[model samples]
Target: MNHTKRSGTPVKRSLKVALVYLLVGGLWILFSDAAVERVVSDPEMLTRLQTWKGWAFVAFTGGVLYLVMLRQFQNDRVMLDRQLGQQEEIRRLSQFQQSVIDNANIWINVLDPDGRVLIWNRAAEEISGYSSDAVTGSDTVWEKLYPDPDYRAWVLERVSRIMAGDEEAEGLETTIATGHNGNRTIAWNSRSFLDAAGRTAGSIAIGMDVTEPRAAESTLKARERQLRTIMDNLPGMAYRCLYDEYWTMKFISSGCRDLTGYEPDELIDNRHLPWVDLMFADESDAVSSAVDDAIAAAEPFSVEYRLRRANGDIIWVWERGRAVEDDGGMVLEGIILDVTERKQLESRLSEMATLDPLTGQFNRRETDRILQEEVTRAERYGRKLAILWVDLDHFKDVNDSRGHAVGDEVLRSISLRLADSIRTVDTLGRFGGEEFIVVLPEMSVDEAWDVAERLRVRVADEPIRVSDGDPLTLTISIGVAVYPDHAESAEGLCNMADKAMYQAKDQGRNRTMVFSQVAGTIESDKSGEA
Candidate 1:
């Protein structure tokens, strides 16, 4: 609209000037000629006056022409000055725009409709390692950047589609071969522009290098895979979880299935059940307390407790964990190992150390230790204590006749009978070959004799059965000794009881004898077998 107004103003001003000139010239001619004809009468005087009028007319017309020319020249000069100023401003604006494009950090390039390079900015030159003088006004830069014919074709096809308005130009990425630097990956955004006639002219593209970022991403992924592999191969379950009552799991390793009989997904975030739910009800509180204490102290924690597996079997587990700071809050990271086998082995080892393997009764060493402890307690409390030393009658005859295997069966049977005959407070142990000792606390001499008789009767009342032979009748000779009555110490009592047992065996087999300390001489009360 402004262009139309500007063009129309020049035409209107020209028309006004032409009409003024015509009107002035027509008025001057009509008025001057009519006045000359009316004022002049004589022929000679009229000719002279006409000549003077002609000269004045000539001068008047010349003056009018001169004024018109001077006004036109002034108008032309003003227009020319305004036009020159506008042209200078346009040149400065173009220079500024070019400076911005050339100095921009991002790669900017323009291509003609025929795919020839039209404008290549300084950034493009720096990124591509190709100068503007080398790339501009030619399409050969495309080949230099993309050496592979097929790849270049694909890139050109995409660009063509963008120019045709069939595909969006934003975020179109491509790899290019730089002139000096190695191949680099780039991300591109492009658009097509139109000329004054609204026809497709050329396209401009902006690119960003993404080579370093892509390399870093790839390295991170590889490291993640390595970490995952290590976790999966571990012998126990490894986990990271929030330090809460539920122990909300953030990550659980693949070993979860083998350790807990549950998949990792099943336990993560308490999807199926919380980790605390797997702990034994009685031990969970102690375990929680230990962890809390360790966390408060900013130290690592280790606890051994029982866990109820998915199949309802209880197993011992050892766990080691530490509190770690995370973005959200404090969390726990740890590993759990099944220690059930180790616990069972330890129990068996303890039994092996204290009990006789054949009969499962206290061995000599453990029996002696218990006797000493009972003696010490009785001495401290001034309570009476008694001990019975019993031996099988003619046990060597059984071993010689029935072989050692049958002898072992007989020994085992007799040991069970002796164990069942004694009170729970009494301790029954194998003192030696075919010999047993029973320690009784808070028992007097009479009570010790009674217990010794009962033990003898219990063994003699039944014929011990063997696995591969007929049952054989057996009997035991018993000896009784009381603390502070016959002996003051455990060793003294054992010696006294042993002497009484040999005396019973000497008198006759299968009888009981009680040792006495009257006048520092040994005495006995003999009881025949039942």
Candidate 2:
């Protein structure tokens, strides 16, 4: 009824419907003709049936056109569905990329081909003191980040290198001074980002604050310098020694030259004398024993021994060391110090306290110390210790007649005689004023009396020929005491022997006496009974 031109599908459907209509119409006409011929008066019925068939054929043709239009509409709907799915996928991928740039921990900043800031992560906002909303679309963002002219030029140079196919710029790590937060230094690692066309669009950088690490490195270097200074300026030798058979010196400070007259290089790495060879033979065992005790206890140790110097002088050194041990109680390290000057000063003070300065003999204080030491030895070994107290008779007369000089000569002569008359184990000391004390360790009272008598006889017989062309003869009255026999305490024994000497003086003034129950009894009378 519309009289419109048909489409290709509609035209094909029309042709198919028309062919069906023709076949149906022909069949109906034939049926009608047969009916007319059969019923001689059925011509009206056949014409009515033919008109109904034509109306049915028109309806079928309209239905075929509607079906073809519906199929085309369904195909168009399917294509629209596939296009919607692709658009959704593209939106999801864009959101994922944006989330990655926003949530990353490292500072990531991207710039467009024209050097305008395009994207900035959260880390970059916090570090650069500029938010993404402020920096995005800013063409001079890097200029604001780095204000120094030289630093900006350096960054541009690196960027140029990256654009010229140089991958070395990718690994570029450097410090930059940013104007933000009062011009602080930032360490950044940079890489070039390329577009879909493989052209370098811009650069992305990650940065952190490296000032603290740089300061820490500088402090470590300063501390090392201070340690070296202290080691170099120390007064005495400081050394690190190994625990091997050689006890090789691994490190020796510069003070080695002052202590042992050896250079530091000569001692380090066992270039010169080893530890065992440094000490005297007689003292090596004692030093080793002390070291062993220190190592076992993880404590400090000290020993006084004789060390041979480079000048062949046997200097007495006091060595103090500490043992450094591992968890297993093994000696892993050792630090040694030289105490030679301290030892010498101690020895000098000891000599001043114990020796008579005029005669170079042991004083009363020294006599007491020697007696106490001998007492300890006697108690330990079940041996006897003897002591002799000798006084010069008529020595005051020499001082009264000539002078103290002449008396000093006589005293020196007596001191020599007394020293020459005793064994090496015996101690001879001046007990002040013309009086002398002798300590004999591990000797019986009999042997002590013999030694005292010999000293007395020698002093009396030996005369001093003075510069005044006169000979002065003197005799020594001695008092002998035995430890644990005559007295027990050092003080008690000295007092007892002193009383015995006075007793001898009261009896004749030139004789040897022993402190006994009978006080004034002379045991030997070796002064020739005067």
Candidate 3:
């Protein structure tokens, strides 16, 4: 803002003005001499007026110079005023920045490379329980603030490194023993001010109190550790695994030993073997496929299957897992528990519901369900299905003449004979008392009739050997009905087969009859009515 006024500049410019005046006056004297000589005859009169004329010429030139110079002075003054105003604004802005630094929520401290505090803000004083005077004047602030000598030295090195050009700036996290207020963790970004030659003048650090957040993070880690302890003691094995075919175990809880007869260390990172290898080989494919499907849908899955333990004992396991994608990779976390007992119980119950208790064949209820499904499938695909209604020709006679126990043996024998006669895909069920129903999928009426005849012959050829009685010959009559040909629905097909079996009985038992005879009669009636 300061511009020195040169001592001789004004005088020099004034001398230049005087020289211009003298040059002009000399010109006037030289040019006007002849005119004055011709105009004035009296010499005394001319001399008296000449002095006044010279004074007037000097005054006129001086007035013209003053006016032009005054205009120049006004412009210079305006420029000086503008410069002064700009300087004032700059000073105000500098003051505003200082105010912001002093009043900011974050603690600010400017320190010399020697660790002497140069500037301490109000926030620093409030947080550290130190006054501005105490902080700024004391070069040994770290003596009370950083109790550990090593820590104090480390803090001092932060600024010293910047000063020594080893670092430009640093982000610092440290703990400060704040007098009686205990300790506070601070996160700071420190930058050093450098002189023109790039030597560090001092360091300014802007920092925030991170004590609460650090404490919260500590609490969270403790809680997680607690939860992990609970999971380790649980009955089931909690596992986090890599998304691979082996379901490679990452973290296996302590329950692994009790659950799988293996220690946690033996399973983690697959130290002993892959966890997937624990499963039955076929079951492994099924479980991995299910897990992959769940991963594609971003969902969880549950399955029950057998696993071979380290003790070489096979046990059923119920596993539930969830797939999560992170960092463009996948992680599967799950729990596996021993469900061998539960699975055995369920299987027993299911078998009791589905299979015949006396004959060990499918019961009537399951038979109906299978027949309905086969009928629907045949209808949907325009495929054929056949129902064979088989009746033991003289089952009641055996039960009446012999004991019920012998009848049971005979029924069991006949069941085995019928079971051996049918293909694997066909279903056989006891149709209440002496009648057994057979469901043949993808079999036409002729094929069903052939099967029925074959089964009848099989039963009759083998004389059932009973402990109490002689070998008795058995005969079975069968009726065949085709789906969507004789009847459309499963119930309709069963009814048609039943009626055909009665027809076989009336035509003399031990024979197979197709339902088309009845259907032909119905069609003939309809034709006659038409």
| Candidate closest to the true structure, highest lDDT | 1
Ranking by lDDT: 1, 3, 2
**Model 3, 421: alpha-carbon shift in Å?**
0.8
Give candidate 1's root-mean-square deviation (CA, Å).
Answer: 5.4
**Candidate 3 lDDT, tens digit per residue, 245-350?**
7778989888888888999888888899888878888778878788778778888999888988888999998889898775798888888889889888999999
**lDDT (Cα) of model 1:** 0.88
- Write one digit per residue (lDDT tens) for candidate 1, span 203-266: 8888888889878988999999998998989888899999888878899999888888988899
Candidate 1 segments exceeding 4 Å error: 1-100, 169-173, 191-201, 292-299, 369-387, 420-427, 439-452, 481-493, 512-514, 519-527
lDDT of each: 0.88, 0.74, 0.83
Clashes (candidate 3): 0
lDDT of 2: 0.74
Of models 1 and 3, which has the larger TM-score? 1
On the 0 to 100 scale, the lDDT of residue 183 in model 3 is: 96
Q: Is candidate 1 or candidate 3 better by lDDT?
A: 1
TM-score of each: 0.78, 0.61, 0.52
lDDT digits (tens) for residues 397-425 of candidate 2: 88889999888888887888888888887
Strongest candidate by TM-score? 1
Question: What is the overall TM-score of model 3 with all chains considered together?
Answer: 0.52
